[model samples]
Each structure stands twice: as C-alpha cells, then as structure tokens.
Target: MNITIERAALLRSLGHVQSVVERRNTIPILSNVLLRAGDGELSLAATDMDLEIVETVPATVGRPGGTTAPAHTLFDIVRKLPDGSQVELDIGGDGTILTLRSGRSQFKLSCLPVEDFPQLSSGELKHNFSVAAADLRGLIDRTRFAISTEETRYYLNGIYLHAAKSKMGSLETPVLRAVATDGHRLARVEMPLPDGADAIPGVIIPRKTVTEIRKLVDEAADRIELSLSDNKIRFGFDSVVVTSKLIDGTFPDYERVIPVGNDKVMEVDAKLFAAAVDRVATISTEKSRAVKLSLVRGALTLSATSPESGSATEELEVNYAESPLEIGFNSRYLLDITQQIEGEGAQFTLADAASPTIIRDVADSTALYVLMPMRV
Candidate 1:
C-alpha cells in the first residue's frame, strides 16, 4: 500500500483511533491498527475487543493496499513530524515492513497481516436515531461523574439510558434520560425524545464508551447518528465511527432512590455556596472530607472540623423558609454537582439529616441530582 496524507489530518485521525488500543495486549495483532488505503482515502481502525473506533480520512493513494502497524508508534512518529508535512506510507512487497517518510525523517515499522486483526462487527443495529451533539454532550458530562468505579457492582459502572415519560404540568411527554449513580450521589438528566427513539430499549453504556464518545462529540458536527441493538451500540460522526458492546448487567431502579417527600426547600447562589463549602472543607478530615450544612429560615452555615486541621466555618444567606435542618455531605461531591449547575441558583430539597437530599438547577429543569448524606 502507498498513500500520502497531510500531517495534521493524519495526526488527528491517529489520535482518535490510537486511544482505543491498549498499552499492553495479550494478542500481538490487537496492538496494531489496521490501515487500508484505497479510492483516494485511508481508513484507520483500532480495537480493544470490547470497544472499536474506525475513521476515514482523505489521502492521495499511489497504490491501493492494506497492512497492520503499531498504533502508538505510528501516532508518535506523525506527531513529531513538522507541521504541514506530507506523510508517505509504503508497504513492502513482502508485506512484513511498512515504511513511513515525512520530510527528511524515515522509519520502518513491523507489520502484521490484515487478516489477523479482529473486527468488532456491529451486526444489524435495529434501533437507529440521531441526536444533536450539544444534547449528547450534556447528557454525558452531567451524569458521567456519578458513574461507579467499583468493579463488583458492574451494573452501576455505566450510564443507564432509556425512554421515559416526564410530567410537565398534567401532561406526559416522552423524553430520553441518562442516569448514573455510585450509591453516594446520583445524577439524572433528560432531553426531549428524538423522533425514531420512541421504541428504543433501555441500555447501559459502559463508562469507557461514555468517555470516548464524549471526546468525539467536541470535534463532531452538529448532529451524531446512533445505532444500537440489545448488546451493541454504534455512534457515527461524519467520517468517524465508534462501536462498543453494551454492559451485560442490569442497572438498579434509580427512581426508588430519588427522594419524593423532601419538603424542606432552600435556594442558594450556587457559586457562592460552592466557594463557602470549599473554604470550610479545608479543615475537613482527609478521609471523610465531610462538611456540615446548618440551615435556618434565612441563613446557612458551612462548617468542617478535623483533629489535624482544627476547624473552619463560613456563612451564606439563602432563601430558605423551611424549618431548621442540619446535614452532612462530602465536600468533593458538593463541588462536583455544583460545577454542573449552569444557573446562578441551586435548589436543595431535604427530608431530614439522615435521608437523601435532592438538588436541582434553578435555570435548567431537565437536570436533577440526589446526594446521600454523610456523617460529619
């Protein structure tokens, strides 16, 4: 195979595809990327068995052929080349050596047979739909922080996506929702259901897949194409395509954890509240990172104490007309949820100090967060 591609274009495509390849692979072919050049374009593909990313970029093809080469090595080589340099890739007649030439630099990389590389077949994705990139980004960014990192509860290690009916006044509207929880905190975000997603089944997208797709969304066009089945999900963004296997476990009934009886309500400026919490948390114990929120009818006090760090306290005036309440929460968790709130104010609904508390953005009704209380 022989092809010439711009360094920037090749570098960009390589950056996208090489991330899927693991640093260590039990199978030799899995460490390489399958490169096929033909029809004035070059295709780069990499897979880690469970997740796969394939991208096509325009190239000047000299002879149509294909081979497999080390993904990371090639990426590093191209990244170091001078900007705007033309990269020429040539595979030898014996098919064992692949040569790369850019400017005055030349390198030879070992190649594997294309037939040896495995393919993650996205077989007959029955459910298909399209979503705005902004919507998709919002769904992932807001919920992914809550995805569990524990391997034992594998089901909670991904975002559960499904079609549900949301109550708007007295009417029900179909919406696509994404939910993630780690038993400590939960995030639920939704948007109006797309036209073709009405019958789509609930699927848990693994944390890794969520991360990879989120990166692609930044460079993606206005819309992204989604195709999925019971066990697989595929995303298409212009010339790039990503396919991943769905998690094979069932997510918990998240609705059951969301507090419905939290009557005590308080509204506080999110930025101000976050800053106060940050300052008070400086004296919190490193292990617990606990901060106490002491709320009265019109004011809230944030305090933290530790044997090593002594104690700290800060006060913020809030719009709270409910009865007095004291609650303890992990300071890191508070910062995480508050960062997601785009609005100036955040509403906190509390049932008691021991029970879960619900928080929502005053400016955006589509996102909700439930944080489990921690003992101070």
Candidate 2:
C-alpha cells in the first residue's frame, strides 16, 4: 500500500478515528487503526468493539491497498510534522512494516494485517433521517449532563431518544425527545420530529457514543444523517461516520417521575440564582454538596451550612407568590440545570419541600427539568 497525503488532512482524520481506539485493549488488533488508500481518497477506521468511527479524506494515492498500524502512534507522528508538509505512507512486500516520511523526518511502525480488524456491521438500518446541526447540538447539550454514571443501572447511562406526542394546547404534536436521569435530576428536551423518524425505535445511546458524536458535531456539516435499528445507531457527517451499539437494558419509564401537581411557582433570573447558589455552596459539606433554597412571597434566600466549613447565605428578590417553602438540593446539579437555560429567567414549580420540583425556561417551552429534593 502507498499513499501521499497532506499532513493537516491526515492529522484531522486521524484525530477523529483514533479516539475510538481504547488506550488499553485485550485484543491486539483493536489497538490499531485500518488505513485504506483508494481512488483519490484515504479512509481511516478505528473501533473498540462496540463503537466504530470511520472518516474519509482526500489524498493522492500512489497505489491502491490497505494496512493497519498503531492509531495513537501514527496520530502523534502526523501531529508533530511541520505545517503544510506532505506525508508519504509506504508498505513493502512483506507488509509487516509501515514507513512514514514527512520532510526530512522518517519513522517505521509495526503493522498488522488489515484482514484481522473486526467490523461492526450496521445491518439494515430501516429508520433513516437527517437533523440540522443546531438542533442536534441542542438535543445533546441540554440533556447529556443528566446522564447517569452508575454502572449498576446501565440503562440510564445514555440519552433515551425516541419520538413522542407532545401536548400543544388541545392538540398532540409529534416531536423527537432526548431524556436522561440519574435518580437525582432529570432533563427532557425535544424538537419537532424530523422526516422519516416517526417510527424510529426507542433506543438508549451509550454515554461514550454520545461524547464521541458530540465532539465531532462541531466539525460536521450543516446537516447530519441518522440511521438506526433496535440495537444499533449511526450518525453520518459529510466526511465522517460513527456507528455504535445501543445499550441493551430498558430505561425506566421516566415520565412517572416528572411531577404534575407542583403548583407553587417562582421565577428568578437564572444568572443571579446560579451565582447565589455558587457562592453559598462554598460553605456546603463536601459529602452532601447541599444548598437550601428558602422561598417566600416575594424573595428567595440561598443558604448553605457545614459544621466545619462555616455557613453562608445570599438573598435575591424573586417573582414567587406562593406560600413559604424550603428545599435542599445538590449545588452541582442546580448549577448544571441553570447553565442550560438560555433565557434570562428560570421558572420553578414546587409542591412542597419533600416532593420533586419542576423547572423550566421562561422563554423556551420545549425543555423541562425535574429535581428531587434533599433534606437540609
């Protein structure tokens, strides 16, 4: 196999594909990336059994063939090469060694047979659709923070993506939604259903896949192609493709956890509220990370107390008209949800100190958050 490619182009594609290869692999082939030189282009692919990323970049192919080499080693070499330099990759008759040359620097890397690499067959992806890059980013950013890290309840480890009927006034409107929860806080965000997605299966995208896809979305085109089945999902950008296995467990019925009877309403500037929480949380216990919100007719007080770290309190005028109430929550969780609010104000609906609280953005109706209260 032989190929001559621009250093920058090779580096970019390598960066995308190498991240899928795990740092430590039980199988030797899994540590290598497959590089194939074809008609005027080079394709790079890497996988860690469950997640695979393939990217194609234009190159000057001297000979059409393929080889597999250490993903991280090749990426580092290309990254260190001079800017605008041309990279030449050549494999001899034996095919056990790959020679890389850029300018005056040269290195030889051990190669593995391309035939040994495993492929994750996408199978027949019956459901296919395209979503705008902005919409896709919104769906991931607004809900990914709530994805659980616990391994025991593996189902909640990724975003639950599906089509649902959202109530619009007196009508039911079809929408695509992403929901994530960790038994402490829940985030549910939705957008108008994309074409050909109404029948898409309810799939749990693993957290690792979400992280990898989100990183590439910024570099992707204006629209991204999505294909899925019951157990697999794929996202295709212009020059990149990511295919991943769906989590096998069942996600709990999250709708039952969203409180419907919370009537005590309060509206506060999200920025101000977040700042108050941050300042007060400085005195909170490290184990609990708790901050108490004391709400009254027209004001809210954010306070935190720790027997060893001391105590702190901050007051802010709010739009609450309901009865007085006090609720405790994890300060980190509170800041995470408030940071997602794009608008100036965040509205909170409360039933009491013990029941769950519902929070929403005043200007955006498509996103909702539910937080379970803690004992102060």
Candidate 3:
C-alpha cells in the first residue's frame, strides 16, 4: 500500500497506539503495529494482549495494501523529522518490508505478517451507551488516585464502576457510581445515569484502561461511545478505538467502609488547607508520614514531627462550631482528596481522633472521599 499522511496527524495517533505496545515482547510480531490501508485512510493497531488501541488517520492512498513494522522505530523516525513534513509510507500488501519517506529521509523497515497481530473482537456487546467526554474524564480523574496499587488484592487494583444508592439525598435513589481504594483511603463519585446505559454491567476498568481513557478524554470533544460485554470493554470516539479486558475478580464491599455518623464537621479553604498540610508533612517521618490536625472553636492547627528531622506547625482559619478534636492522617492521602476539591472551601467530618474522616466539596455532594486515620 502507498499513502501520504500529514506528519502531525500520523504522529498523534502513533503516539497513543505505540504507548500500548511494550518495549519487550516474547512474541516478535507483537512488537510491530498492524498497518492497513483502505478507502482514503490508513489504520494503525497495537496491543499488549490485554489492552488494545486502534487509530485511523486520513491519507492519500496511491496503492491500497498493508504491512507491519516496529511502532517505536517508526515513531522516532517521524518525530525527529521536520514538523508539517509529508510522510509517505508504502507497503507491498504481502506483509514484507515496509518503506518510509519524508523530505530527504528514507527508511526500509523490516515487517512481519499482519496476520500475526492480535485483534480485539467485540462479540455480542450487551450494552452500548454514550457518555459526555468531560463526564467520562471526571469519573476517572476523581477516583483513580485512590485505586489500589497492591497486587495481592488484585480486584481493588482498578476502579469499581456500578450503579449505587445515592449517598446524600432522599429523592435521588441511585446514580452511576465509581469507587477506588487502597485500604487506607477511598474515593467515590457519582453522576446521573445515562439513558441507554442503565443496564450497564458492573465492571472494573483496570489500571491500564483507566490510563488510556485519560488520553481520549483530553481531546476537546462532546461525547464518547462505550461498549461492554461480560469480559471486554470498548470505547470509540472520533478516529480512535480502545478496548480492554475487565478484571474477573470481585471488588470489596466499599459501602461498609464509609462512615455515616461522623458528627464533627469543619470547613476550610481547599487551597490553603492543602498548602498547610504539604508544609507540615515536610517534617513527618518517612515511613509513617502522619500529620496531626487539631481543631478548636474557630481555628485549625496542623503539626508534624520526626525524630530525624525538625517539626513543623501551621494554623488556618476554619468554620467549625463543634467541640475540639485531634486527628492524625497520612499526609499524602489528605493532599490527594484536597487537590480534587474545586471550590474555595472543603468540608471535613470526623467522629473521633481514630475514626475515618469524610471530606467533600462544600457546594458539591456528588463527590466524597473517606481517609482512614493513622496514629501519630
């Protein structure tokens, strides 16, 4: 196949598709991207067996054919060439050596049989729905930080997405829910269920899929299409398609971990509170990393101490009329929840020094984070 494509357009798709390809592959053909030229466009497909990403870019086809070539090598060759340069790719359709030409640069890259490339098949997808691109993005960004990295609890290593009973109000019974946790902290967010997606299967989008979904979300688009079956999930938007295998293990019962009777509530500016915690954390012990929060009538004080380093202390004006309380939490967990707060004020609820603290944006009840308290 012979085709000419704009460097910028080709590079954009290659950058994403190649990221899904691993640097080392036990199967030699898996290291290459399957290129197929057809009706006015060329498609590039790459997969790491578990995650598959495919992109189609518009091209001027001289001869319609296909081949496979090293994705990273082709990416580098085009990346170093001048911007806006026209890249001409030609393949014999027999899946042998492929050729690349740009300006004065020329390359004959070794190719493998395109038939050897793995294809992600969408077989009888039970549910199909459309999600606002921004909403899809929010669902991942708000909870992904809490996803467990621990390999032993493999089920919790991804975000658990399902329909959940609404937490705040009486009228709204259930909403689409996304939850993530790593034992110490948990983040949960909700959005009104989309029309066609009501029967969507409860699925765990693995860590890898969560990452690739983030890239598609960054594009300035209004909506995205999602397809899901028992084991696989696929997302389609514009010229890109991303498909992945869902974790087969079951996620933990997250609702039990959510505290309901935390009576102490304190409101503080998110930006200021995060800044104070960051400063005090500098003096926290490397292993424990605890920061103590002491709340009095009208003010809150943050302090941390380490046997090897100096201590740090700071204060912030807060809105809390409850009795004084002292609590310690992992500084990193506290910062993560606060960073997601969009508005000026963040609401914190606590029952005791050892109880888990609940945090939420003062104006938005759709998102909430619960952090387990730690000893000082």
| TM-score per model over all chains | 0.99, 0.99, 0.97
- Deviating ranges (above 4 Å) for candidate 3: none
Instruction: Give a tens-digit lDDT track for model 3, residues 218-283.
Output: 883688988888689889888888999999998888889999999999999999999999999999
The whole-model lDDT of each prediction reads 0.95, 0.95, 0.89
TM-score of 1: 0.99
- Cα lDDT for residue 195, model 3? 70
Candidate 2 structure quality by residue, lDDT tens digits, 107-194? 9999999999999855778999999999999999999999999999999999999999999789999999999999999999999999
After aligning candidate 3 to the native by TM-score, how far in Å is the CA of 57 from where it should be?
Answer: 0.7
**Candidate 1: residue 327 Cα off by (Å):** 0.5
Worst 10 residues of 3 by lDDT: 165-174
Error of 2 at 177 (Å): 0.6
